[model samples]
Target: MADNNLWHETLHDHFGQYFAVDNVLYHEKTDHQDLIIFENAAFGRVMALDGVVQTTERDEFIYHEMMTHVPLMAHGQAKHVLIIGGGDGAMLREVSRHRTIETITMVEIDAGVVSFCRQYLPNHNAGAYDDPRFTLVIDDGVNFVNQTTQTFDVIISDCNRPYWSRREPVHLGLLRRLQTLPESRRHFCGPKRGLLSAAG
Candidate 1:
């Protein structure tokens, strides 16, 4: 009877504290990545990879909207759009907002990133993945740009900095290929691509 009573007391003490806190950091690990999802907290959830914040529970829209809309509005009428390296699909979401866009082609190197964003970062990408107007081509942006004859009214490069030794080569190749498309008005954005002077 004494042991039973002690067990009951311990259970009450332990389980009782669980409900007191409304939120906690739940650590989750997978074969491909490790993530910490903020549960019942202000930020809801975020995917952290290699100690870097990949996406957050809130304010993703603000970033996406600002990145895409500013240039799009400046162009006035963007019927066709091309996105390079934005596997997150948030840019596509903002791009689709413009009614003038007839087609949007997104070139993503990693399909896994897109899949992960669709599943885990739904708040950021939402249902933009399912939109018919958004066409995803799982290919290198440099190669895709070089081979394609299709021109875009606006081209948004969402790639990260060129860390690879061949990055400049790829960038030059893409730029050279883009120059051949006389109809398409090119607009280069993002960190690495933005560094090049207009004369270069």
Candidate 2:
């Protein structure tokens, strides 16, 4: 019994140390949400939704600037933009920097993600969620893209490849819908562009 107790104590201590170094423990009591907090040295206490790290104090600018500037500079004069799967609103905050952008639409499937980001990751989004020019849609990104008759000057795919790949049917359906759009040019970011083209 003493040996078993010692082993259990060792295991507990190991797990506690791992959690202390790697993640911030947020007590999640909500019925429909996964809340996490990261004890990041630079970002301090960082809160995230659904186990996804939205941003850290150390590297938010790098991601925001890269995601925004690369495409905005490439297009040169984008007046409207569409973002698929960036529920964190970081991309929206970046897109708002360009004065040329008149409208920005963000489509994310999880409303919970958006709500959580608004509460936790305020620095990343910069309160762009409430902007009048920004339209937030809580729906399947593909369905949102398919039904829209309006074509954007630029479309930013801000989703993770692995997650989108897991939902192949939805991703493929969206690609097919995008092909039907009148726009001659389509630009895709992230790792799943090949799958997108295949679906198209």
The most accurate candidate by lDDT is: 2
* Candidate 2 residue spans exceeding 4 A from truth: 1-33, 45-54, 160-176, 180-200
Evaluate model 1: give its TM-score: 0.63
The lDDT of model 2 is 0.61
**How many pairs collide in each candidate, listed in order?**
0, 0
The TM-score between candidate 2 and the true structure equals 0.67
Residues 9-70, model 1: lDDT tens digits? 12232441111113334445544445443432444555443333444566566667777888
lDDT of 1: 0.59
Q: How close is every model to the real structure, measured as TM-score?
A: 0.63, 0.67
Candidate with the greatest TM-score versus the true structure: 2
Provide the overall lDDT of each model, using Cα atoms, as 2-decimal numbers.
0.59, 0.61
Q: Write the per-residue lDDT of candidate 2 for residues 6-123, one digit (tens) a residue.
A: 1111223244112222444443634545655455554554544444344565677777687777877876767778888777777888888887789888888777667766776677
Off by over 4 Å in 1: 1-42, 48-51, 162-173, 180-200
Worst 10 residues of 2 by lDDT: 1-10
